[model samples]
Target: MFVEVGPDDFSQQALYDRLCETDRASQSGAVVTFTGRVRDYNAQGHIEGIELEYYPGMTEAALQQLLKQAQQRFALTNAGIVHRVGRLANHAQIVWVGTCAAHRNDAFNAASYLMDMLKQSVPIWKKEWANGEAEWVAAKTTDSQAAMRWLQETDEPGA
Candidate 1:
């Protein structure tokens, strides 16, 4: 498992290749990855960019805990997550989450879990630019609703 929070931009392909190399490619049968990007606009109208803020050690610790939970729940063979900080322009990649497991279901589910947990637990805050004004982005109830779905799944069989 690996967790990183920094200002550098990273590519999904590079991460996957590294994973495959670190863990023999023959062992894991599935690999799942998710990438999130900064959009050009938000409800505030045209967005020039977004600035993400986080507490140094706290942010990395939270992400590491999330990865550990995912590994325990899904029995993932390998997992990695990288989140960008500082200012990012519209269309710039913001985050990447990846997982590899012996089965496809585990890989997919673990990746999804990491992303959701990042949304819920990470201390990072995003400020978007609108009409040359900066506005802090608010958390949406819909995200909590989505999180509830995962909670429900954990109660079901084979979760």
Candidate 2:
């Protein structure tokens, strides 16, 4: 498992390739990946960009724990997540999650679980830039609902 939180942008293809190179890749039959990008607009208006902030060490530790949980819950062979911080323009990649497992279902479920949990539990904050002003983005109820769905489901592979 790998977890990274940083200001540097990442190449999704490179990360996917690395996931395929994991020690147990030959034993895994499926690999799932998710990429989140900054949208050009939000409910407020047209967006210029977004700035994400997080407490460095604390944020990474939280992400690492999340990865470990995902590994255990899904019986994943490999998993990795990368989240970008600082100012990012519209359409720039914001986050990437990859998971590999012996079954396609496990990989797909693990990827979704990681992204949903990250949005709801991580300590990252985002400030949206729009109409010549910036505002701190608030957590959406939809995000909380998404995360709750996983908790409510008892069909997890390793549960």
| TM-scores for all predictions | 0.93, 0.95
Highest TM-score among the candidates is held by which one?
2
Q: Rate the local accuracy (lDDT) of all candidates.
A: 0.86, 0.92
Query: What is the lDDT for 110 in model 1?
Result: 85
Off by more than 4 A, model 2 = 24-26
What's the residue-level lDDT of 155 in candidate 1?
A: 46
Across residues 67-124, which tens digit of lDDT does each residue of candidate 1 receive? 8888888888888989999999999999999888888988998888888778878899
Q: What shift in Å separates residue 130 of candidate 2 from its native position after superposition?
A: 0.7
The total number of steric clashes, by the backbone 3 Å criterion, in model 1 comes to: 0
Model 1, position 136: C-alpha lDDT score: 92
Q: Please state the error at residue 20 of candidate 1 in Å.
A: 1.8
